[model samples]
Target: MAHKRDKTPRLGVGGELWITADGRNLGSHARMGLLRAVVEQGSITQAAKAFGISYKAAWDAVDTMNRVAGEPLVERRPGGRGGGSTRLTERGQRLLERYAQVEAVHERFVEMLAREAFDLEQDFSLLKVLNVRTTARNQFLGTVSALRAGAVNDEIELTLPGGMRLVAIVTRGSTEALGLHTRAPVVAMVQAGNVILATGIESMRFSARNQLPGTVLTLTPGSVNTEVLLEVDGGGRLVAVVTQASAEALALAPGLRVTALIKASDVLLAVTV
Candidate 1:
């Protein structure tokens, strides 16, 4: 008689799992795996070696995980004869166990799903439809606060979170075709190149239709241009691309206050649907 194989052949899908707490990512497979290794190895150094990662990277991952998880996943032990050791806390053990259980169930579900025949091309098309990419540097999700329809064009006032408003100009036909109305949700996009920044103004006047005062958040300098990010009052942000020389002349840095100006006509509007 011929010998038989002990395990049956099975088809399954493999993927990594990332967990989050309250919309903040807590940790992923590698980080959590490091936690488990630390528990087994009884030291972070050994765990890092086993994982083939730097000690600093392992420590940083642990710190971030604990911070984002809102509790300590690993705790340091008091120094002993050898040295101070690192071990996973109770929460870490529980998290690892929970992840193992979920992974088992997910594997089973995916195997079942794979057994069912489906059109992969159709699914790929749906994925493409769901992903929308745009070059505009500033995009805000808001609701139409007011609508002014004229003979040829329509003026829309969009209210963002924290009661900030942005005005956009579009043709009347486009507005109606997009089903845009008061209180309707829309996203406003403005290119960074279209924004103007100003600072140290006491009594200056400008013709820009939209003037937003905000604090400089970041400045990224490139070859010839610099990208400036400002946090607006209430809740919003504006990005401006300016010459590096201009950034230096203005002395723009983090926490320095500035105003972003954009013409209403430059604000592009889009609907989710």
Candidate 2:
């Protein structure tokens, strides 16, 4: 008897094309469309209408692009009988042509990615992790190693890539809301201010649930506070902010071994949907 074939869906890759000048956004697909419309219609008002944007908004975009490019892309042409018309400058026309070439190449690149990638979902998830930003200074990507449920809170054990583990205490509501489970990927965040630093605590015990020992990588002093960067074991880094006086008291300096103490509750857990 013949067996049935699997019918699982596959993921695709896609991206937007943008041109930048001096780190500033100069043009995009929509902006190029507006330029093309101006070339065909020969009227800013009509171009704006075709581009589905207000006249002023279109002018603003054009002005920004022109300023960033250090050259006028679109210009007004004096008309004899009818109102003045709008047209693209020589540079503007060249820019449009070049953008078309780049867009075609970009389309092919995305198509290749979609066709050649064996697992697009994992690639997309990695992109999402790289794109995450937060005010917290410490961010670690790890997987859930264990979970212990409590009456009102849940104890979560996260294992980092280098074999180091971190424990976090999150409310029961958050545990359910994040859909956290064993072996699930998660991001752990801890603010610099929440981290405490100590030196020569090899034999002493700490009430804090997390004690990460590492060498002082760097110490940055500020007016009132000092930023300490630690190169922890398992190839992870932790940043801690301590007062200038406290930093001096511990003689915190690069190459000195120190421990970062953090409460289990201070670690924030997040997962991508």
| Candidate achieving the largest TM-score | 2
Writing each residue's lDDT as its tens digit, candidate 2 over 1-273 gives: 897868766866789899999888998999999999999989889999988899999999888888999999999989889988999999999999999999998887677667655473332222233455588888887899999999999999999878989999999999999999999999888999999999989889998999998999899999999999998977778899999999999999999998899999999998876
For candidate 1, the lDDT comes to 0.83
What is the RMSD, in Å, between candidate 2 and the native fold over all Cα?
16.5
Q: Candidate 2: where are CA atoms >4 Å away?
A: 1-130
Candidate 2 Cα deviation (angstroms), residue 66: 51
Backbone clashes in model 2: 0
Error at 154, model 2, angstroms: 0.6
TM-scores vs. true structure, each candidate: 0.52, 0.55
Give me the displacement of residue 254 in model 2, in angstroms. Answer: 0.4
Worst-scoring 10-residue span by lDDT in model 2 = 120-129
Q: Provide the overall lDDT of each model, using Cα atoms, as 2-decimal numbers.
A: 0.83, 0.88
42-142 per-residue lDDT for model 1 (tens digits):
99899999999999999999999889889898999989699899988898889988988987776665554554324332211111233457888787878
